[model samples]
Target: MATASMADKAKAKADTLIDEAEIASSASAGDVQAELENLRRDIAALTQTLASFGSGKIKEAGMRASEIGAEAADASVQYAENARSSFLSAEQDLEAHIRNKPLQAIAIAAGVGFLAALLSRR
Candidate 1:
C-alpha cells in the first residue's frame, strides 16, 4: 500500500509540472507579440511627425527666399533713383558753367574738335 501511494503522488507531481511549463510558454509568446505591436505603432508615429516637420521647414525656407528677393529689388530701385538724381545735378552744374563762360567754352570746343579730327586720321 505504501508503494502504490508513493507512485501515485509522483505521477501527480509530474502532471502539474507539465501544465505549468505549457502556461509559461504561452504567456511568454503573448508578451513578445504585444511588445512588437507597440514598437510598430511608435515607429509609425515617428515617421508621421518627421514628414510634417520636413514640409514645414521647406515652406519656411521658401518664404525666407521670397522676402530676400523683395528686399533686393527695393534696394535696386533706391540705387537707380540715387544715380538719376546725381546725373541731373551734374547736368545742371555743367549748363551753368557753360553759360557763364560762353566765349572760352567755344574756343575750348573748337580746339578739342580739331584734335579729334587729326587723331582720327591716324
Candidate 2:
C-alpha cells in the first residue's frame, strides 16, 4: 500500500510539471505571434517610405534633364547666331575686295574656271 502511494505521488508531480510546461509553451507562442505582427507593420512602413523616396528622385532627375535640354537649345541658338555673323562678315569682305580690284578679281575667276574645267574632264 505504501509503494502504491509513492507511485501516485510521483504521477501527480509529473502531471503538474506537464501542465506548467504546456502553459509556458503557449505563452511563448503568443509572444512570437505578437513579434511577427510588429515586424509586418515595420516592413510595410519601410516599403512606403522607399517608394516615396524613389518617386522623388525620379522627379528630380526629370527636372534636371529638362534644364539640361534647355541649356543645350540655348547654346545651339547662340552658335547659329555666331555662324551667321561670321558668314555675313566674310561676304562683306569679299565684296569689298572685288570692288577694290575688279580686274584682278576677273582674272582670278577666269583662272578658277579654267582649272575646274580641266579637273572635270579628267
Candidate 3:
C-alpha cells in the first residue's frame, strides 16, 4: 500500500512539470514572433533609405559625365583650330623661304627626289 502511494505521487509531479514546460514554450514562441516582426520593419526601412541614396548618386554621376563630355568636345574643337592655324603658318614660312632662295630650294628638292627614288628601289 505504501508503494502504490509513492508511485501516484511521482506521476502527479511528472504531469506538473510537463504542464509548466508547455506554458513556458508558448510564451517564448510569442516573444520570438514579436521580435521577427520588428526585424522585418527595420529591414524595410533600411532598404528604402539605401534606394534613395542610390538614386541620388546615379543622378549626380550622370550630371558629372555630361559635364566632362561637354568639356572634351570643346577641347577637341579648340585643338582642331590650333592645328589649322599652325599648318597655315608653316605653309607661309615655306613659301617665303623658297622665294628668298630659289636655287637652294631647287637643289634641296632634287636631293629629296633622289633619296626617295633610292629608298623605293630597295
Candidate 4:
C-alpha cells in the first residue's frame, strides 16, 4: 500500500512539470512573433526613407552631369580652334624655311631616310 501511494505522487509531479513546460513554450513563441512584427515595421519605414532620398540624389546628379557635359563640349570646340591656328602657323614657317634653304632641306631629308632604313632593318 505504501508503494502504491509513492507511485501516485511521482505521477502527479511529472504531470505538473509537463504543464509548466508547455506554458513556457507558448510564452516564448508569442515573444518571438512580436519581435518579428516589430522588425518588419522598422524595415518598411527605413526602406521608404531611403527610396525618397535616393530619388532626390539621382535628380541632382543628373543635373550636375548635364552641366559638366555642356562645359566639356565648349572646351573641346575652343581647343580644336586653337590647334588649327597653331598648325597653320607651323606650316607657314616650314614653307618659308624650305624656300630659304632648299639644298640644306634636301640633305636633311636624305639623312632622315637613311636613318629610317637602318631602323627598319634592325
Candidate 5:
C-alpha cells in the first residue's frame, strides 16, 4: 500500500509540472501576439502620416533648395565684382609703375627674359 501511495504522489507531481509548462507557453504566445499587433498599428499610423505629408514635404524641400540656389548666385556675383575690382586695381598700379619709371621697367623686363632663358637651358 505504501508503494502504491508513493507512485501516486510521483504521478501527481509530474502532472503538475506539465500543467505549469503548458500555462507558461500559452502566456508567452499571447504576449508575442500582442506585441505584433501593437507594431502593426504603429506602422499603419506612420504610413498614413507619411502619405498625408507627401506633397507638402516635397514643396517645402523645393522651396528650401531654391533659397539656397539664390543665395549661391548672389554670392557668386559679389565674388566676381570683387575679382574685377582687384584686377582693375592691379592694372592701374602697373600703369603707374610704367609711367613713373620707363627705364627701370625696361631693365626689369630684360632681367626677367634673361632668367627665363637660363632656366630653359637647364
Candidate 6:
C-alpha cells in the first residue's frame, strides 16, 4: 500500500508540471504574436517614409534638369548674339575699306574673278 500511494503522488506531480509548462508556452506564443504585429507596423511605416523620400528626390532632380536646360538655352542665345555682332563689325570694316580705295578694290575683284575662271578650266 505504501508503494502504491507513492506512485499515485508521483503521477499527480507530473500532471501538474505538464499543466504549468503548457500555460507558460501559451503565454510565450501570445508575446511572439504581439511582437510580430509590431514588426509589421514598423515595416509599413518605414516603407512609407522611403517612398516619400524617393518622390521628393525625383522632383528635385527634375527641377535641377529644368534649370540646367534653361541655363543652356540662355548661353546659346548669348553666343548667337555675339556671333552676329562680330559678323556685322567685319562687314562694316570691309565696306569702309572698299569705300576708301575704290580703284584698288576693283583691281582685287578682277584678279579674284580671273583666278576662279582659271581654276574652273582644270
State model 3's lDDT.
Answer: 0.98
User: Candidate 6 clashing pairs?
Assistant: none
lDDT of 2 by residue, 1-122 (tens): 99999999999999999999998877877798999999999999999999999999999999999999999999999999999999999999999999999999999999999999999999
Candidates' C-alpha lDDT:
0.96, 0.98, 0.98, 0.97, 0.97, 0.98
Q: Which ranges of candidate 1 are over 4 A from the true structure? A: 1-33
Error of 3 at 28 (Å): 7.3
Name model 5 segments beyond 4 Å from true.
Answer: 1-49
Tens digits of per-residue lDDT, candidate 3, 7-114, equal: 999999999999999988778777989999999999999999999999999999999999999999999999999999999999999999999999999999999999
Model 5 earns a TM-score of 0.58
- After TM-score superposition, the amount by which residue 105's alpha carbon in candidate 1 deviates from its true location, in angstroms, is 2.3
Task: Please give, for residues 1-122, the per-residue lDDT of candidate 6 as tens digits.
Answer: 99999999999999999999998877877798999999999999999999999999999999999999999999999999999999999999999999999999999999999999999999
Q: Identify the runs in model 2 with alpha carbons over 4 angstroms from their true place.
A: 1-28
Question: Each model's TM-score, in the order given?
Answer: 0.66, 0.75, 0.68, 0.52, 0.58, 0.70
In candidate 4, stretches whose alpha carbon ends up further than 4 angstroms from where it belongs are: 1-54
RMSD of 6: 8.4
Question: What is candidate 1's lDDT per residue for 1-122, written digit by digit as tens?
Answer: 99999999999999999999998877877798999999999999999999999999999999999999999999999999999999999999988989999998899999999999999999
Report the C-alpha displacement of residue 14, candidate 5, in angstroms: 31
- Write candidate 4's Cα lDDT for 1-122 as tens digits: 99999999999999999999998877877798999999999999999999999999999999999999999999999999999999999999999999999999999999999999999999
| Superposition error at 101 for model 5 (Å) | 0.9
Estimate the lDDT of model 2: 0.98
Once model 4 is optimally superposed onto the true structure by TM-score, how far is the C-alpha of residue 65 displaced, in angstroms? 0.5
lDDT per residue, candidate 5, 1-122, as tens digits?
99999999999999999999998877877798999999999999999999879978999999999999999999999999999999999999999999999999999999999999999999
Counting only residues 3 or more apart in sequence or on different chains, how many pairs clash (N, Cα, C under 3 Å) in candidate 1?
0
